[model samples]
Target: MKNIIILCFVCLVTISDTNSSSDGKEKCEGIYVRDKFHKKVVIGMGLNRPYQLAYDHHNHKIFFSYNIGKDDEDSFQIGFLEKGHIKHKVLKEVENGFAIAINNNDNVVYFGGSDGIYKQHLKSNDSVIEKILSHQNIWDMFFKHHLYFIAYPSQKLYKYEHRQNKTIPEHQKIIHEKIFQFAIDGDEDKFFTNETGLYRIKNSTDHRIFYEGPKVYRAIEIDNKGVPHFSGQNGIFVVNKKNDTLEKIAHVKNIFGLAFDNDNNIVYSDPHEIVKLLPEDC
Candidate 1:
């Protein structure tokens, strides 16, 4: 999934790498608002192709994977924000470092690249990159009870169990289509999204469509209380847990990655900067 063009759920729109203004501020375009309002703020700047944000609740930092330069000159690196500064220490650059995950319980951050999956202890003073899985191309991944990922080209879901040290196909049921990204709610309810819509797997037997909006949602994230947020071309949308309704929260253009900080604020990326969407009242 190199240089893949992601589409929105409601309509078709394409995103570019640069959309800054003449005065050096990034211009947010194609905004479509709804009932709720959120103030968008740029938390970090000067990045290239930042994708897939994972938040560390313990340290309250956002870790992301990005590429410098383009095409043949591309170099992959992992970055994290510190004290509102773009401070990043490259753990170890790998081939196509596109996926990133952080385990708060183990205090470890995992990086998935074309070569394999590598992990580094976050709280250690002398952290070193250690290869956990090799020779597998990982496109997008996340850490729950285990590592859940969508392997590129095939686009099927696989689970990597750390305790057993095994990678196996999701044996509960068979997914017929390609899956993009997935998230588990606070209740440990598993949900996934594909070309059609978002689906929930209940009791490992019932696979049903949860939401049918956005034909091609790129990123899906859940907050601390199990509320789900989706990102596409239009903006960020949230599924309300109390009333079971979908509402547009923020209208961000070309939003790449989706994440929720410890405070439940939305953190996402555009082309060249990382943005945060916070509630206006908060």
Candidate 2:
């Protein structure tokens, strides 16, 4: 059944590539944020190569990956900052890593690279660096029901069941040639992605398109009111699931990462600097 699905997906990819004109030429505008009162609190410095971002809800901290140099072969480092603090602490460094996901415990983090999947125990400073599956370049990772779901840009999905000590193919229902970004809601029953526009996957077989846009890099499902917040080359978009409306909240030209805190604050990082979106002064 899975092989059949992969074959069908390959056919679709060929068709889409032939029909489409270079993945849409529209570039995102308004890439910076200035307060209504003209206060520029956040700034983008442009880093070497930044990738995934994760929020530690329990400790109110945000984590992100940063490359050391311009070369794609440069080493990458994982760092985190407190909710209201601007300083960051480098947690770990690696040769090549991306698509990182921090466990709910805020102590365990999972990431993938050209090699395979790995886990880091933050508290003990010990890591379980093992290759779960070979030849899979992971683009994103998230936890659902204690199981780790990894998305590979090459249209492959993997689930690592901790209890079973095994990795298996999952998300057989999604049929996209390439998936740029995806976000798993806390409940694990629903997820949003930008494979063929923003889509909500209710189950392995049930799903719906929330909205359509250019290729997206990252996304998060906001619990404040269930808004589907996403970032791409253009800017940031907030999808109102209740009314099915998409609003362009802030325009950041190069959005590398995004996360939301328990207090409903939004945090994002470009290349060099990280910024937070705070509510208007009350």
Candidate 3:
């Protein structure tokens, strides 16, 4: 009887494993309420490791950077999903790379890889790789009013003016001197970074601690209203520039990427899913 009981337990374990794997294989479809707590919209396949996500309002397409395998060795591709169809084009074939941004025109995509910064033009069907200032790894990039902002793990901020075509040092005033991620305000006057703490830079002013918390991954200015919203390990927090109030919007395990659609829909990526959260009334 003891052996029979043991055999039954073994069988149960096997069945459970099978079910878990099956669930992982099943593509999550439609919108789901995360743990039944908040509404979520899922897009694309179950991504094993998604590096970044960007939305192209011009084409109504969502782009995803996916890395495959243990050291990210197997595959690295930039894919787009639109109108229920998914298509991908290889940007890199190596492991451990980063995608910075997709140009508003959807004609150029910039990414940082183990080698260096790469620019790919969709129209010309060509790619150019250039070495940026640091090899420590670039985390993100944002373009505002012809100025390009590059964030690096070294906590340094660099800006490149399109007209001048040169990298300028913009780190002398940053508080922590170590920046993890950042976002530029639409107006080009203010920008926020996630370093040892939340820091904001404007008009050459040095780092000013705005909020203190775990490392932040991404930030976005909502509605061109100057209210800065950021995503970190603790969840999403919003800072009201006018009132100087910081408040939590929602909570998730980890946010890897963030983008706001034209309709004010907040789209972000958590571990295995891409979620879109609309305001309660909407």
For candidate 3, the lDDT comes to: 0.56
Error of model 3, residue 127, in angstroms: 9.4
- The 10-residue segment of model 2 with minimum total lDDT is 29-38
Q: Which of 1 and 3 is the better model by lDDT?
A: 1
Which candidate wins on TM-score? 1
Between prediction 2 and prediction 3, the one with superior lDDT is: 2
**Model-by-model lDDT, in order?**
0.72, 0.59, 0.56
Q: For residue 189, what is the lDDT in candidate 1?
A: 63
TM-score of each: 0.77, 0.67, 0.66
Clashing pairs for model 3 are: 155-178, 155-179, 173-206, 173-207, 175-207
Ranking by TM-score: 1, 2, 3
On a 0 to 1 TM-score scale, where does candidate 2 land against the true structure? 0.67
Question: RMSD, model 2, all Cα superposed?
Answer: 16.2
Residue 176 in model 2: lDDT:
40
Count of clashes, each model: 2, 8, 5
Off by over 4 Å in 1: 1-37, 71-75, 87-89, 162-172, 240-245, 280-282
Off by over 4 Å in 3: 1-38, 71-77, 86-90, 93-96, 105-108, 121-136, 147-153, 162-176, 187-189, 213-227, 279-282
